[model samples]
Target: MAQKLKKNTAIALGNFLSQFKAEGNTKNPDVLNNNLFYDDFTDLIALSQSHNGWFTPEQVYFAIRSWAEALTEANLNEWLSRYDFSNVQPKTVGLILAGNIPLVGFHDFLSVLISGHKVMVKLSSNDQKLLPFLAKYMISVQPELEESITFVEGKLENFDAVIATGSNNTARYFEYYFKDKPSIIRKNRNSVAVLDGNETKEDLIDLGEDIFRYFGLGCRNVSKLFVPKGYDFKLFFEAIYQYGDIIQYEKYANNYDYNKAVFLMSLFPLLDNEFLTLKEDTSYASPISSVFYEFYDDLENVKERLKNDEEMIQCVVSNNLIENSIPFGQTQQPKLWDYADNVDTLTFLNKI
Candidate 1:
């Protein structure tokens, strides 16, 4: 029964997602105007920015299209096929979501439900609207799901386990609070890129998406770079120059101006490309509108360093320079199975 419900639910989600494709002007006839979801979706795209300044229509649409591609029956089945659910007992799993990016916590919501558990979600205030709207659509498609999904506004209670994502500070609070419960508490982590100075212009341009998408708010965004000594920034800066218009956004421009001023006041040298700034630093988490970089003498030593610091890194992007690193452009486009912090939520849920 759980398998059937989840499979049908994936189809329903896919159908709903099919309406937002970039290459097509088509809407699913079955999902007519009377359903009110389509109209609401249109309104979401229009109002997302008003709700959260960073939730621009383009970012929201990209998120929608990415989910649409992920929710297909084949992908869902392939992801779920590895798990054994016959002995599972349904438990209420509580979620404390992060609002760094649109629908960032949707995967956790999906994991709880598809694993035959009830989900009680505490939506991040910055991203409160869209997921619940989609949850309504899912419930409409599968009435059984209504009993399995709950959105909580206050304290998360009456749950067997918890999954929470937040910064290093909030994580400390979560850990002490939920210490008694079986929980997955995610703390601050950042992604980095390794460059050998031989990358083509197209590769560097694509790498811009890894840096600037969602305005660099996501953990998957490449916040740092590892470059060889004396690596020239000319071609790399030229390639990413196309994204210079990003400075036009007030919030981003404000950050750029503020962070640049802070750096200059400290007398730190920087490589400025008008829109994005590159600073020489060893940290993994860089502020918005800036990417910190470190010089590496040997790829072997850097790989070992990353291995030792794996907990602080979410992903590594490169042209296969390091084994297991993600591609240059695809950091944010994670597969459903690419669990954050390398924690397997499904396996954890099944165990509990």
Candidate 2:
């Protein structure tokens, strides 16, 4: 039964996701032909904001498109090729999803299914609709998945292993509770960028996408920066002006105003461009609509610091300054194999 999981099924799922990428209420012709799925998608777009204020139609569509691009037959095969599932036994894998960004847990869902494991999903209240709807689509494409998926509401039990994602505090509880089970307990992590002052204006513009997308809510977003001493901010600010419209959203505007006031009250100097604020702080987890920056005289020292604090960091964004750092505008656009925290989920499932 496990080997019956076919690559064509993955491609069909990708094609289904591709239909919802267009911005606004428009639907692809193929999607419109499926009456039930089309109705569900339209309702998803309409009610997403009410479910989670950050889940605007645009952001949800962005998430859908990203998954659509990743789930192609070639991408799926490439990602799965690294793992040998020849001896995978069907065990139930429990998932505790996060709701920081729209469909944030879809990657885990996809990983479990493709690896030939039954998944018991406990979705975050903030992100309830999208994944389950897609799960229905998956069952429609491959009926075998219908018997392997379950969504729990109260407590997570009756599973062989666990893969839980939560904050550092909740992680402690997960560690204690799942002590007897083979598990992957994820904790809080944030991404940072290294700037050498030699980057082009275009690079800075793309970097803005890394910061503002998802309203700086996802773990992959660059919430901190490492800039050389005396780096000029004039060009960076000018290039990121296109995202200034973010302040128009009331939720983002409120957060920006509140965080900016807090900075001013603490007598901290900041570089503000009306919408986004940059403060000289050493912390990696900055609030919404703001990014924390620290000055560095030596790139090597910064690299050493990042190495020492690797667990606290998610992805590194740089223009060839930091080794293996993600390219600008690509922190959020991770490939199918870019496992979170660099922990291979497929291998974990195989062993469990």
Best by lDDT: 1
lDDT of each: 0.90, 0.89
Question: What are the per-residue Cα lDDT tens digits for candidate 1 across 237-349?
Answer: 99999889899899999999999999999999999987888999989999999999999899999999999999999999999999999988999888889999999999999
Candidate 2, 123-201: lDDT as tens digits: 9999998889888877877787888899999899899999999999999999999999999999999999999999999
Which residue ranges in model 1 land beyond 4 Å of their true spot?
21-25, 31-34
Structure candidate 2, residue pairs in collision: none
Estimate the overall C-alpha local distance difference test score of candidate 1. 0.90
Of the candidates shown, which would achieve the greatest TM-score relative to the real structure?
A: 1
lDDT of 2 at 257: 98
For model 2 the local lDDT of residue 72 reads 82
TM-score of each: 0.97, 0.96
How many clashing residue pairs appear in each of the predictions shown? 0, 0
Error of 1 at 225 (Å): 0.4
